[model samples]
Target: MWVLTQKINEREDKNFSRKCLLCRLQFKGCRADYLSHLSRLHNMQLGQPENLVFIDDLLNCIETRLESLHCLFCNKLFKNQTVLKEHMRKKQHKKINPKDTEFDKFYIINYLEMGKNWRQVKNEPDDDDDDDELSNAENSDRRVSVGNWSDWEEDEDKVENPVVCLFCERSSSFDEIQSHMNNAHGFDFTRISVDMDFYHQVKLVNYVRRQVYMGHCPYCDKILPNRRELLEHMSMESHFIVPQMQLWDQPEYFFPTYENDSFLCHLNDHQDDMAELHLSKKMEEDCHIGSC
Candidate 1:
């Protein structure tokens, strides 16, 4: 590990010797990686001397009591600047904050940690199982019986502007509703699964005022009552694998077709093998016979 670290450090240093902006060295390093290292390791050492003076000036900016500046990740307020500075170097804050607009490559990690103390509050086995049961019951109530999940209500209300999925109508909170829409109903997930990333973020400023509803975890089949909790769970574990519709190629949403003998469900194992072989041969022929 030490050897690998040293090699990485040497490579990084050589790269830094290039045109790395943070290092200000004319070596072959990239600006992005250099900036990331600087931001993580030497935030206070950045901007200008004037900026450090500005942060120092912020110490006096408070109107009344001298409460220490808050660390953005943990939201822990320190009594002194030294402690706050030290806290920045700890593993708790080592993870990137996607919330920071300036750092483009930064992301929210430790999704389990992102559960926001909810895991601690409800770590008991019975409580977790109860949560899962409640979620299943709710899903059963809201599950659309239509052929296509997206098409169920889209035809009537398909407008130019994006709206929340019909399933997300029960979400009383704005953030939860948005997450639901993005996860379930936003994309044409019939052909392919949507990327589970949120480009926009809304603060949980009014979380206490808003009643968070429970949602089913796409993996492990657990239930989480909070939207953030669900997102964290998704990040920690595989909620949805990339759609495997291509592996068992039939139609887009083709399940084992039971209606007809020609369809997949009615086919025996030997028939399935023959069908696959035919498909492979056809694919090979297509590859050979390229468009003229």
Candidate 2:
């Protein structure tokens, strides 16, 4: 009986290490340590059923982790049940039992292969007109119009210089004004993209400025005189507009203008930091691939 128990312990020890479903990190430890690692890294809670579906290829000895926490309606993967529920609520993902097997196969497989091919081509030397040809085709087919500069001329004329902040009634450079707005008033213009037309962009900036200056809560329709008081009221009442920028249609037209110059500068810095972090992580996980 003691010899049988020893054999069972040896078998369990050999298969002790398991790969995390989310981050794909192979962990070798006791159950408590593994659970702690999962909780710390992936924010996975105990007693929560992680519906991970695994398929093994016996010929190749390869195990593939199939995505199970995905919305069939949207075809989007979620981190967990809480996030999935939030996404379902926001996107209104409803059940549509349409026969989409063929469509799904073509879209999922062919599209992924096409994307991989495109990435490979993109990484190669600039020796062909493939990119230009694709860009021209896309531009020719796109119907979205970014409004002309003439349409926003009237509003531009209202301020002495294009860089003046109407909220604080301060005249400064575009960069300074943007920094001031972001730091002091919580006006995150970084969220605004270059896809927005001059008219809408100007309107959005002016609207937020007006709201902050007037101490008017658009949600609750309350007017307060004090700035501090208004901020408190807004925090308590959750009165704020979520700015949504349209997708970039014309990549060539999207340049760093005086309006978005500061935001773009910050964005570049942020992207650089992310790239460095990603490189470091890749280096750390270089030898740990396919250990499961």
Measured by TM-score, the strongest candidate is: 2
Model 2's TM-score against the true structure: 0.25
List ranges where model 2 is wrong by over 4 Å: 1-162, 169-171, 218-220, 235-292
Candidate 1: Cα lDDT at 103? 30
lDDT of 1 by residue, 146-198 (tens): 43667855664432213232233343222344466456644232223122111
Q: What shift in Å separates residue 95 of candidate 2 from its native position after superposition? A: 58
lDDT values, one for every candidate? 0.35, 0.43
Q: Put down candidate 2 lDDT per residue, 145-245, tens digits, no spaces.
A: 33455656665434333355434555555557767766665655655424443334434444455555567653454788887687777666555443333
- Cα displacement (angstroms), candidate 1, residue 47, comes to 19
If scored against the real structure, what TM-score would every candidate get?
Answer: 0.18, 0.25
Least well predicted 10-residue stretch by lDDT in candidate 2: 51-60
